[model samples]
Target: MTKQDALFQYCLRLGDDALILGHRLAELCSRGPFLEEDLAQTNIALDLTGRAQLYFQYAADLEGRGQTADGLVYRRPERQIYNHLLCEQPNTDFAYVIARQLLFSAFDRFLLEDLCTSKDERLVEIAAKALKETRYHLAHASDWVYRLGLGTGESHRRMQQALNDLWPYTGELFEIDDVGLHLLEAGIAADLHTIRALWTPEIRQMLQKAGFEQPADDYMHTGGLKGIHSEHLGHMLSEMQYLVRAYPEATW
Candidate 1:
């Protein structure tokens, strides 16, 4: 693929991660365990959506095919999306939500920091903006991981179980292919290999502080980078796309 195509794909990957996870968190609005948690989640969802717009806008300009960010976000089928599998997974429960956030946010925080130094001016600005939000996301989720992990037996077990189930998907966040290498070579992307060194240790420390043991499962679930995802993404697409599908260009 050409350099432009590769960079566009890279932006889509970043946009998809923010969009999918933002929507996932938005689902907790008014459905959280408490009012404060609900507001917190909703706020973070807004932050993520904003970050997604930046990436999607850049991707559209890079593609230069007259595709707007809205078109890319609302018009694509689930199979065309390149979000990580972890972001597409269902919230399931509160413990599951925090577990997913903790793992992904921890990785995101570090990755964005590395990206802040990227040679690409637009990407560096976006990464710098995103890193600010991701740091808080990591902190909040980590607190809950500790709270639930050290609480009563039932809460502790649930948190541990969520970690075990979600751990498999975490590996996908670090899988760099030729597209990644292309960006890296151009100084438009950070080396995830180096990021992984930091991510792994921080995650280990977080889990230990929460009193949760890391699962021994060697099989790491992947494939979302190639547009292959779990069923949850399809359902999410249906809801997210309904308005766009019904109204081609509705503007209020």
Candidate 2:
């Protein structure tokens, strides 16, 4: 693929990850375990959705397509999406949600930091803006990881299980595809392998402080980057695309 194609595809993946995860987190808006947490989740959800909007805008410009951000987000097929498997996984419980956020935000924080220096001016600007938001997200997730992990016996057990259950999907976050390779070679993207090094240590330290043990790295699940997602994504798409599907040309 050409450099522009590769960069555009990579941006779409970033956008899809933020969009899908934001939708999942939005489901918890008024349903958080506590009032304060409900507000916190909603705030994060807004941030993710806002980030996704920015990504889709850039993706549209890069693709040179007439598609608007809303169209790209709400009208795309499953295979066209490039989110990591971890982001699309089911939000089982509070602890599970926090685990997902902890892992994703930590990875994103480093990714954005590196992207802020990209040779591509637009990407560098987007990354610089996103870096500020991601920093807070990482802090929020880290705080929750500690609170749930070091809380009461039940809370600790649940958080630990959440970590173990979600561990397999974590591998996909660092799985670079063909597009990523092109971007990396062009100096428009960060090396996922290098980011992984930083991500692992930060995650490990957070888990340790939370009184949680790392899960055995037995099998690593992959394929989401290639559009092969878990069953959960279909349901998420159904709900997210409901209005768009129902009224193809309807506008607010």
Candidate 3:
């Protein structure tokens, strides 16, 4: 693929990740464990959704196909999306939510930092803005990891279970494919391998502080980058696209 194609796909993947995770977080709008946290979570969801729009607008511009951000988001098939698998995982519980956020935000924090130095000016700007939000997201998740992991016997157990269940999905975040390789060669993409190095130690440190063991990274799930996703994404799309699908020609 040409550099433009690779960049387009890259933006789409980033946008997809934000959109799905934002939606997942939105599901917790009024269901947070407490009032302050409920508002915090909703704000984070908005941050992610707004980020998705930026990335999608860039992608649409790159594609030059007259597609709007809303069209790309609401009209695409599930298999056409390129979000990471971890973002699509369900919020089974509060512990599960924190664990998932911990994994994703930790990596995203470093990834966006790396992106801030990318050769592409647009990517650099997007990354710079996103890194600020991701820093807060990482802080929030890391705090919860400690709170839930060290809270009580049941909370600790649930936190550990969530970590174990989600660990397998983490590998895909660092898996570089052809598009990524091309972008890397052009200096337009962040080096995930380098980000992985930074991500591991911080995650380990947080887990250590929480009196929790790190899950083994032996066999990880994959395929999200290639538009392959878990069953949850389709169901999410069904709900997320309901209005758009029902009124394709309606303008508001």
Top candidate on TM-score is 3
TM-score of each candidate?
0.97, 0.97, 0.98
Candidate 2 lands at a TM-score of 0.97
**Candidate 1 lDDT tens digits, 24-65:** 999888999999999999989999999999999999999887
**Stretches of candidate 3 exceeding 4 Å from the true structure:** none
Best by lDDT: 3
lDDT of 2 by residue, 1-252 (tens): 888788778878889989989999999978998899899998888988898999889888887858788888888998888899999888799988988998899999999999988898988888888889889988998888878877799999998998999999988888887788888888998889999999998888878877889888889999877888898998999988999899988995
- Each prediction's RMSD to truth: 1.1, 1.1, 0.9
TM-score of 3: 0.98
* lDDT of prediction 3: 0.93
lDDT of 3 by residue, 1-252 (tens): 889999999999999999999999999988999999999999889999999999999999999879889889999998899999999999999999999999999999988988998999999998899999999998998888888888999999999999999999999999999999999999989899999899889888989899998899799899998899999999999999998899989865
lDDT of 3 at 17: 94
The CA-based lDDT of model 1 is what?
0.91
Pick by TM-score: 1 or 3, better one: 3
- Runs with alpha carbons beyond 4 Å of true place in candidate 2: none
lDDT of each: 0.91, 0.88, 0.93
Q: By how many angstroms RMSD does model 3 differ from the true structure? A: 0.9
